[model samples]
Target: MPPGRTVRFSLSLCLLLFSALTGAFAAPVGQAEFERGVAASQRGEHQQAIQAYLQAQRAGFDQPALQYNLGVSYFRLGDYAKAAQQFAQLTRDPQWAALAHYNLGLVARRLDQPDRAADHFEQAYRRSDNARLRALAASALDRLPGTRADAGTTLSATVAAGYDSNVALAPDAETVNLSDNSDLFIEAGAVVNHRLSADSTRARYLFGGLHLRQYLDVSEFDQQSLRLGFNQEQILQRWQLDLRAYLDNIHVDSDRFEQSLNIAANARRTLGGGRDLRLHYQAGLIDGGARYAYLDGWEQRLGIDSLLPTGAGWLRFGYQLELNDRDDLEQNGEFFSYSPTRHSLFARLTLPDAGHWRYTLRGEYRYSDYDDPYRISNGTGTTEVPREDHRYLVGIRAQQRLADRTALFVDYRYIDNDSNITAYDYARHQVMGGIEARY
Candidate 1:
């Protein structure tokens, strides 16, 4: 997800609360209930606030402010259907229409209806009077899976410079000692998306991106990549379906490294309490850059991503199975084939925000096993042995908001890889600081 899109949603929610606090509702008999609801909402008692709001509504209090408060309460209570209904009704009021549609879009996104969400966000963008709110709405619209053909296209770019302690990831102590070199690198990427469909329930888009990276002293490790893709997103009740097909090309050290054509499909279902489940499958045919085509293969993966709430921040986890079938010849003119299975686990702990600074700690582990033996030649002999590897990674990042559309961040990461093969064991550490801006 883009930071601009996420921040826009947060800002819109704050505007909703601000409107509730400043707007007045006229219901002689329900005045007390409305006041109580506002107090309860402020105190984080969303269910109690919902009850009071419902009572006020029952007492004939039907105003934009009342409806907006009720919608926020329902959203906090994880009742998106009721929240959407409440906000949809507020779209008739000229003063509240834009914000109401923005809230509806947020609700639609939570319900896994990306197409409908885009429609609501576009409406909010077109109808908003506040420049900031309009910009936020436009940002949100750009991030939606797909949009109507008449909708505008989005273009974004990022540039960063960092230093790496170990570029090649080689073992520290071995017959062939690992080479360690520190170098500064710069990376940049740009992406553009153009909508191809006009329907809200079913949308399609064409996307293209280019990425390039260069190391100051390690020019041999420089990389460049290009990707062209098409995406289709559909909403069906409580489920969202995403289909993508892409062609990717990569160049390393100014030489063609790899090229592939891939197709993927994913299904996402939103659950209560801000949880979601996603399942995906991808297939690709890869061609390698080597002279003998040793890395040419068919790749396939099946994975699931899940989110669960914790006392503090949410916990996101994912698991995947990958298979690579090599269809090339080895150096000795023998057909090479191997099946590798990998398991990965990850967790992140997001601490409570302190003023303008946000902090996160994350950890990941991965293990891989190879079905066939890999032949390795040392000083004296050559031996074939099944390969196994374990990798552990930990990272910490802190971000400070510089403005509504920009932030500064510093991050540090450590990685350790242990393998049965001595040449593959390595450890690395990296530190980077950068600024991110959105437009």
Candidate 2:
């Protein structure tokens, strides 16, 4: 065999035998044939290895490692179906179950059975104690056509401190109300997922999250938000469909600001070579506080997202159309209706990891056009003009993994808004650092 191929086989077999030989086994009657099979495999004579291993099995010398070696030989010979069968037989052996499942996943993928591949990979990820194998299985699961609920329930939390140049998104320092501040924020979330199909192609999940933010000097800008949601996903061949419903509540300065109910649906299709295309739609109803009742509205959005490979990284692009219709637009001294149509474009680049660090860069642009002109009252009296706004955003983030379940990250973002109305134009910059832990 080629040196590299021999080394690869040796590494895989070593992992397989790590736990398989912990218990006593009877003396093999077919020891000679078994040794011959191992020698044949070392010489890259996979057909000869297969014949020898079969003869050994017939002589009552069956063992987990023997079956594993047989499966590997069949795989090398391009007999994926037989390889899958051999691996399946080892799934009952505790020591080799996860390893068998991992190999079965590879065979399934080669046979063009993505759903089965996902199932096997999920099993391997859930059962394996080897960190490298678990990571490989998880990566395979992510690239497959389905959602895996094998992880069951999970809890996560995050906290960060950051500075914001424009805390209220005001146009400029000369605007009516301008504030720059630093704040601390914390978030906690939980999710529970259950499989709904025996084939592992359908699942339902419940999720909830809470976020709180406190500004050091701006008590009136403190914010809190809560979200509860449910999601269902189904996989069919190369297509995956997701349905979601959620409720959100927001409070600012200890006063209720907004409450909303939202519904969304998405469909994604794999286009080969780690590429994917998705289409989504969302609708929501918004209710506002007394001072912001004029902003109460119904919102609708339709969007598309695509992922493509760019050298060693991935490029993601998205476009969406948004429409908002306010219930009572001419309230609270607002002269014009608060209805608008918006078009948004966003793109992100995720670069390959370098050593322990990973990097991402993103940009977004949005244009909004209102149905009626905006009116503002000033010292000179009332001014009116057709309302239009443009917004640009860019951000970069870097993360380093400190351990298996821990990471540290730093991020920076910039935003610039231009509008025919000065009160709505603004420029801002922000920076933040945070650490995350998972269990």
Candidate 3:
């Protein structure tokens, strides 16, 4: 089908499916009335058919399926709000929530309440099992308000634990190449959002996270970290200003604690499409104090992130220049100074699907260089050099319509790594599959 027609049909199909689920003949109206209504509908007697359907409904025919069909008929009769209302009701049904959420997004979109549409689309994208439909909804979200006035604050958390075959003490330094490894990593996080002005001229967002990791291979390699940060954005029409601060603390089970504080303020240009172009610089100091295995360091970075439209796709391109200066705190004359440059590119696409489904694809490439880097070994007498390398990754995701959830996915990645000191090169490829479920 032509692109133009495809969009039109997608809309119609959503309405039809949602309505059909809510409309059927009412009980006690008798089979005869139902047949008459069908005959009338076939003969273009829509008014008569509607009356018969209502009679059936009034006669106690209120099954869930009947309700859906009635709603569809009403929608076909040009009653959108009624259709929306019906779809909304089905959003709670275990069997119908997926399609219900999709239709709900359409209803909200037609009503000119884009934020509501966005919320529903997000729901649909997260709940649907159809890759194509979820992808479409993800794209739709980008068109909606990235920062809506009434948007609810979001909270997120992650917990990860994996068994490692090899764990080293300063793997970059090749201090010990111990293969017997045991480590567990866990994190918890939360965030809150507040709009500081009626026009959103000023806004503040706050977040915090906690991390704990333990390694068995190194015998006594356990560490914990805590983070606190806040960013305030000042809106100056098309231009934007931001102020940010962060504190990070690291506690080692076998060593004393170390911490870092960083403060940064930056300016950004609105780049349309829920994106921005930013130029930023940051300065910070890391201090291990008098009782640590190594000396502390000074760190600084200059960065630029520009949203660019590439051939057949849109991408975020960014580059960072970093400087690090460290003095040996434990011993004299063991100091190092280094600088590194990093660049990254990311692209994303979301497309519509048949039957309320959607799909999404994203690709990313990143490269980094270090001037004072040394070799890294993988426990088995291998050396790596501090050089330039890149990582390539791609992900494909899908959302289902009938169930209002994401049920499938495909992902792939490739990595090329070279060490500075030992001149070691490591390359890897990976593929993954994932599922999204909603209740």
TM-score of 2: 0.67
Candidate 1 regions exceeding 4 Å error are 1-151, 173-179, 332-339, 350-352, 378-380
What TM-score do all the candidates reach, one by one? 0.67, 0.67, 0.51
Record all residue pairs in model 1 with backbone atoms less than 3 Å apart, i.e. clashing. Answer: none
- Tens digits of lDDT, candidate 2, 235-317: 77756799999998999988888899999999987554445689999998999878778769898999999877556466889
For 133-196, candidate 1 gives per-residue lDDT tens digits of 6666766776666443334576656677788777767764232343435578888888888877
Instruction: Give the per-residue lDDT digits (tens) of candidate 3, residues 271-359.
Output: 43234588888877777755653437777878787644333333455666666565533223232324445566666665434344556
Measured by TM-score, how close is model 1 to the native structure? Answer: 0.67
- lDDT, model 3, position 72: 51
The global Cα lDDT (0 to 1) of model 2 is: 0.74
CA RMSD of each candidate after superposition = 10.9, 12.9, 12.7
Task: Report the C-alpha displacement of residue 254, candidate 2, in angstroms.
Answer: 1.1
Of the pair 1 and 3, which is ahead by lDDT?
A: 1
